[model samples]
Target: MNLLDIEHLRVDLRSRERRGAPRTVIHDVSLTIAPGEAVGVVGESGSGKSMTVKAVMRLLPRRATVGGTLEFRGTSIPAMPGRDLARFRSQLVSMIYQDPRAHINPLRTIGDFLIEGVVASGQMNRAEALEAACTLLRDVGVNDPQRRLSQYPHQLSGGLLQRMMIVMALLPSPELVLADEPTTALDVTVQSEVMAILTEQIRERSVGLLFITHDLDLAAAVTDSLAVMHAGTVVERGPSADIYAAPRHPYTAALLASRPSPTSVARPVSIPGRPVSAFEAGEGCAFASRCPYAIGQCRTERPEPRTAGTRTVACHRSDELEAVLAEGVRA
Candidate 1:
C-alpha cells in the first residue's frame, strides 16, 4: 500500500512582479511511495528535485510558495490546517535537511538535540526519548553513544554529525522520511557507510523513503524508483535500474553521460551547458537551446510526457533519444 502520495504538484519560485513570470520550479509532478519503497529524485541543481520533496514536508521557504495537490496516506495536505499539520509533521513525515550544520544547534549538546527531536515526535516522553536517543546514536554507528552525546556538534566529525541528524529524523519512526543529500559532505567511504546505516535502519521499519539527491549513481545504489527532473519538470521516471539503463529524456541522457559511473570506463562526457535556472524559460522546450539533436519542432514547441516501455519521457522527439537508450540496453 502507498503510504505517501503526491499528484499534479506544482511549485513556482519566480515572482511576476520582479521580472521573469510564472516560472514553475516544480511543474505538474506526481510521485508516490509504497509502504517500504525507497524512491530517489535525481537531477542537477535547479531541476526542481528538492522543491517537490520540500513541498511534501511543508518546509518550503515563505518566499518560494507551493501549489498543486499534496497527499499523504490518501489525504490532501493543503487542506490540513496548521495545528493538524504540526501534528502530522511529528508523526507522519520527517525531513533531514541537506546541511547538518544548519540543522544542528551549535549551542546545544548532541544529547539535548536528539532528545528534543524525539520529544517533539509527540509519541515519546523524556525517559523513553532518552532511551531512543542512545539506541539511535548506536544505530547510526556512533562509537560512544553516552560519552559522545554530551559533546557539542563541533566535537563530532562531519560524518558523525550528518549521521546524527539522520538519527534525529529516524528516531520518531515516522511513517515517511525525506533525506535530502544526506551524505554529500562525507568522503566516498564515509558516504557508503552512512548509506549502509540508513538502508539497514530504515529497512526494518515499513517507513516510506524519499531519498533526494543530485547523484544519479548514489540514487541508483539505493532507490527502488528514480525520477529525473530537468528545467523544473520531471522529464523521466521509472524503476531505478531501468531509468539508468534506458533514460528516455535528453536531459536525463545528459545527466547519465556526465555523471561518474563504472559503465563510463572512458572519461565522462560533460553535458555541455550548465543547468538552466528555475527562473528560465523560452518559446519552446526549456532545454531546446542546448539539446544536441534539437530539431525545429523541439525548438518551436514543448512536449508532454510520452509513455513507453515502463518509463515516462517528456520530449517532442523521444524516438531519437530512444535510439540512444537502446544502445545502453545492449551495453
Candidate 2:
C-alpha cells in the first residue's frame, strides 16, 4: 500500500468579506508516495505547492474545506476525528517548515522546544528524549549538543536551526515527512549540507518524504518522482529523470528552460507572463495565455490529466509538444 495518497484533491478558502464566495486554491492534484520514497513537488510561487502540503498537515484555516481523497495507509485524513487526527499528526507524520526561527518560540530554550512534543505525545520520557536529541544533534555535526540544547533559537545560526528542526521532526520516528522549502533561507553551501543531512536521515530511517520546493534541479536530484505544478494543478508528473529529459507539458518545459544553468553559456530564458492563482484560471487551461504553443482550442477547452507513456500530463497538445518540449530542455 502507498504510504500517502492524494487524488483529485481540491482546497477552497472562504472569503472574509460578507456574502463573498469561497475561492478555490487547489483545482486538482494527485500524488502518491510509497515507503521510503521521496516525491518532489516543484513550481513557481503561488502554484499551490505549500497550500497542498498544508492540507496534508491539516494546518489550513478554519474557513478552508477539502475535497476528493487524501489518505495515509488507506485511512482517510479528512474523516479522522479530532483525537485520531491529533494522534496521527503527533505520531505518524511530521512537518519541517521553511523557516525555523519563525516556528520556534522566542522565549523558550531549544531544550524546551524540542522535548515538549515527544514528551507530551508519550513517545519518550524527558531523559530519553533529551538523550535522543543530543544524539541527533551530534549526527548533524553540531558541537556540544548539551550546550546547544540549553541555548535559545536566537543564539543559533540559520543552518544549525534548520538542522535542529530536522532533528525535532525525526524525534517522533514519523513514517512520512512534509518538507516545505527547508533550505530556502540558507546560503548555497549550507543548503547543500542541510539537504545532505536530511536525505541521509530519511534514507537511513526508511522514511517517506513529500518535498516541496521551487528549485527544479534540486528537487529532481533528491527525489525519485517529480510533480510539476502550475496554478494549483499538477501539469506533469513522472519519474524525475523522465520528466527532466522529456517534459510533455509546455509549462514544464518552460520551467526547465527558465532555470539558471551553470554549465550552459546562454542566459536563462524567462517564461512570458506572470503566474496566476487557481481562481484566476478561466474556462480553459491556466497556462494557455503563457504557453507559446497554445492555440484557440487550448484557450477554449480545459485539458484533463491523461497518461502519456510513463507520465501523467494535463495538456491539450502534449502529443505534438513532446518533441518541442524535449528540444527546449536540451537547449
Give per-residue CA lDDT, model 2, range 1-331, as digits (tens): 9999999999999999979989999999999999999999999999999999988988999999999899999999999999989889998999998999899998999988888889998889999999999998898888999999999999999999999899989999999999999999888889999999999999999999999999999999999999999999999999999998888999989999998888978999899999989989999999999999999998998899998667999999899878888988887
Give the residue spans of candidate 2 off by over 4 A.
Answer: none
Q: What lDDT score goes with residue 277 in model 1? A: 62
Per-residue lDDT over 259-322 for candidate 1, one digit per residue giving the tens place of the 0 to 100 score:
6666557667687878886567566787888888789988778787777877777888887668
Each model's lDDT: 0.79, 0.93
TM-score of each: 0.92, 0.98
Model 1 stretches with alpha carbons more than 4 Å out: 14-23, 261-265, 328-331
Pairs clashing in candidate 1?
A: none
Question: Which 10-residue span in candidate 2 carries the lowest summed lDDT?
Answer: 301-310
- The deviation in Å at residue 57 for candidate 1 is 1.4
